[model samples]
Target: MNNLGRNLALWVSIIVMLLLLVDVFQPGNTQHAAQQLAYSDFITDVDTGRVRSVVMQNQNVSGTLTDGTAFETFAPQDPSLVSRLTGKGVEVVAKPLDQEGSPLLRYFLNALPIILMVGIWLFMMRQMQGGGGRGAMGFGKSRAKMLTEKQGRVTFEDVAGIDEAKGELQEIVDFLKDPQKFTRLGGKIPKGVLLVGPPGTGKTLLARAIAGEANVPFFTISGSDFVEMFVGVGASRVRDMFEQGKKAAPCIIFIDEIDAVGRHRGAGLGGGNDEREQTLNQMLVEMDGFESNEGVILIAATNRPDVLDPALLRPGRFDRQVVVSNPDVGGREKILRVHMRKVPLASDVDPRIIARGTPGFSGADLANLVNEAALAAARLGKRTVSMREFEDAKDKVLMGAERRSLVMNEEEKKRTAYHEAGHAITAVLVPESEPIHKATIIPRGRALGMVMRLPEGDRLSMSKKNCIAHLVVAMGGRVAEEVVYGKDNICNGAMGDIQMATRVARSMVTEWGMSDKVGMIAYANDDQGGGGMFFGGAAKNFSEHTAMEIDSEIKRLIDEAYDQARNYLHDHVDELHRLAEALLEYETLSGEDIRQIMRGQPIERVEVDETTPVNRRSSVPQVSGPEIVQPGDKPENDKDEGGEVHPVPQPG
Candidate 1:
């Protein structure tokens, strides 16, 4: 029922109950007095001898004659006058009792029901408001949800994009399913498996899938949930959580964002007494305290493994650490297909193509892309999601949602068009760079324009030439602005691009053995000391003079690459102008359109200089300076270092 109708019904029921209670408790004598007052005048007119039966109006009064002289003059005592007859001629005698109780006692006894109803209402209100220590006392109860195998919906089939991680975790499921198999082989099962990766990589999802596959109970909670304002609450929760998990043995405890409570103690300004530290200490103790016989396994996920405590990561605690990273092309395709199952997709909508377009997308990103595509189709009142919708959805996901209402002046639009076109042309022409996916003059997120490129596949090792090409592509937009609109038109739009290029250049010189002067040495900093502090040894591969020479060489390389791009665009100015104009008109253009304008055909093959060896490619002939190094030979400084130079390994 509606609220008003329910309230009215409650009011009516209460009123009826009150009236019935009043009737049951009302004094009978008081009502009898009311009736006698209506017949007072009639009884006074009755003669003594003829009044054998006296009728006073509609009520009958019967009495036995106590004296015979009452025939001459008869006077009935007034019900209100009975108390005033105390000092009169006759003495009144007591009458025998006919009923058992007084009316006053019955009235109070019947009011008991109303008192009970009031007591119940007060109790319920106190509980709901968390008053009277009713609901408030339950605050320390565990928030971890216990999910049985029948209740779990996620299995191995539901998760994608991390096959290696899955394989590692699958062993844990096997151990949980059949512990004796490992014991017979003299193998001890790992107590805990830490899933470490960036956010949105499906770490928590994998844990759930493991529980579902093993058909075991799953207890899921966040790391922060164990902490509370009280000092000892966190420790208490950790104890209780483990105690519960032990009872439900052969279960998995999935803690997401474990970094919240598992950070290194005393690392923060907040001392060891901090609640989070207390919680972490308790967790360490609990994890270590358990015997190998206990089947309860702990699964924790975190994006920041570096910040975790060393004690917690020692062998018996977190025995295995699985890194779940962004999906590769094949993995991305699998993730996309898994997400696309719920979407009403057209026949032409290919998950492989979508996956190829997104190089760094996580599993969450793929799911969001599919959801966005479905939303786009629904907005247009379409039955199925098409390729165009998916493309738009991808743009929306990577960038921000479309801002059609974000109007810009004509000059700004032109600048954005040229900027995007510059990136596209440069990336397309550069041999070591990936192919351009899309270039848009439309404002997306904080960018005035954007250019997107998809890597051919995941790269584990990047060559020096490939690194330089990437830097050149990054600087293309600024170079285009300088070449076309002069240096005066350069803006802050290239800040991210500049930072990226600088990092790549630094990596080349220090780590990749790309520089001739700073040959076969690494000066890269490991920023895990505290708050990303850089700490490392210096590069002894070069002298002060050689350092200056290296700096000059890097600048000259960037300057030459910029000039090459500018000259190429200058020779094909008409094509550049056409592409820019098309971008301004359409707001977005594909790589094929830009390719057609440049070469009048699609790209056949991206050239790779195989004639030059990988180590010698950086020493190619240039405008000035002596050749620094030869192929398969260390520099003179290598002997100074007391050994032959070998290439430093690249960062993983």
Candidate 2:
């Protein structure tokens, strides 16, 4: 389409240039050769009867001589001169020069300026009205790209994952190919298919795949396209779009992000009758209205199905809602392989390993992962993307980039080194905690130091033991800081760790039904919950004593985890010092490195007193990287608009 647009502009420019050339570059070869005789010379020739068939207009005269040579001369405007020439036996005519010869070219030249000015005026008006550009359709029209059957060659084979979604849409292709096959069984094709999925799940890609399978016309538009400031413009465009779709029967119209337009009515306090609702109403009617079965299927995609208007999802409107979810383990491997096919990868690069690392990554996310790996390799001037670059890309995606330029004093470095070492040791010591991948004092995102962990595999439901173990691991930083440097000497670098640990303890007591004192009772507002009860959901119909019991249980759980971590670190004080010294020397340590160092010293479980003394320490803030508390946990790194985490913020 872009090529077609360029070609159209080129042709228009060529035509415009040709018109200007004809007007400005006409040759005057014959005019220069014609004799330019004065009025007296012309009269003399007329009196001698040598001039024949003379024509004159406004002092411009041309005549044929007796010698058969055509000559031109200037004559004073004299009405009687023509009669005198006729009396002298010279054939004469009194007419405008253009009328006596070719007048069409003169008329065209006169009209050209007016035409050009009108064309320019119209072009300026179009530009002002935002009607695409000059010679484009009106602004009120749909901006959908009309793709032919041949244009979209991205078939189901080109796409990967979302097997269920593909299966749901495959029937639409069969219906379009031969509607009789379904109608014979009274299956009358579905009027619309709403693709519901999370962002980056390849909803739009699947729509194109359907188009490719159908081998029919495809009209691709965004939901935002159906919104306009003018009240009726949106409805007009919706009508026009449906009309076009009906005309091109056996076609697929895919509207990406349909929730933008089809949001529930009366959602905003701004008023009921708004442009978007009216447009959505019209779209609803057009979908299941009269002549709905014109061999046209509407495919709409949105990550937010819960927010869409119920009317739009009714039985006849969007008859089917296909949930396009993130790919599973095998599915993710397949998706990675599909994306890796185009890029040159080293022999050591394994898609299965990458798929295993990325548990909840959507198809689009996996594609970006592959692309990022390739770009990383290219930036390093490598011929092929190796597993090393892929690993770096994955880390860069999950955690922010390493802030190598961040300078830290010896004391602060020592604190950060110990903080990360505490986390690494706790993770290895905790019974059900995930294995630590790497530990580093290298600043990443808002973190001063971090201990990264990779889950053994995907876990849907985390056991109570694992959740509590995570709580102990999260509190390890604060516990180690308090034991090594006194309690007051523990800076707020362990702030993220504290918050994660507290949340898990609170969840275990309030929602997970694991607390002995609050046994089998949920104090949370909603299921799987971490929300205040005041806003909405189930009423907290419990007594004040029950609430106090919940709070006490939460505090008791956190204190227990804290005590466990403190005891573990106190017992392995020498090993913890060794790990921290390693971090201080190398600025980083792998899981294997921590394991190797601890292998020399056997771990001894120890119990410690809860009361610890606080020693005065500087209040300088040190940011640290987030760690996954469990298999399905996400880090606290802030994501930018492009979904990538920004650079590690400067430590305060």
User: Judged by lDDT, which candidate is best?
Assistant: 2
lDDT of 2 by residue, 1-652 (tens): 7647886887688667756655555565325477777778888888888887787776788888998878888876687986788798877677754545465676467557766876787787676545644243455666678877564388999888788889988989998888899898878888899998889888888998888887888999998877856687678888888877877887888999998899999978885459898898889888877655478789999989988988998998899999988787778878998998878766556676667667678888788889999898889897777666776787777776767898888898888878777878888998787777667787776787777766665565667777777778777888778878898786877777666666677777777788888998767654434443543335564667887888898888888888999989999988889998888887766566678777765322222221222211212111111222223323334321111111111111
What lDDT, from 0 to 1, does candidate 2 have? Answer: 0.74
lDDT to native, each model: 0.67, 0.74
Q: Per-residue lDDT for 1-652 in model 1, tens only? A: 4545766787678767776767856675343222222233423323232222221221233332333212222235556432332223232343443567886576556766775786687576555433424233334555678877564389999998799999999898898899898999899888899999988989988999999888888999998787766677678778878877988998998898998889878877645459888888888888887454288799999999988999999999999999999887788879987887766666556676676666567888888888888898889897777666777887777666656677888987787777667777777778876666666776666667777665555555667666666666766777767777899867766666665655557777766778887677664443333333322353243456755766676676666667777766666667677787887776765666567657655323222232332231132122111211111111011010001111222344
Top candidate when judged by TM-score against the true structure: 2
Residue 312, model 2, lDDT: 92
Model 1: lowest-lDDT 10 consecutive positions: 634-643
Candidate 2: residue 637 Cα off by (Å): 5.1
Kindly provide the TM-score of model 2 when superposed on the true structure, using C-alpha atoms: 0.72
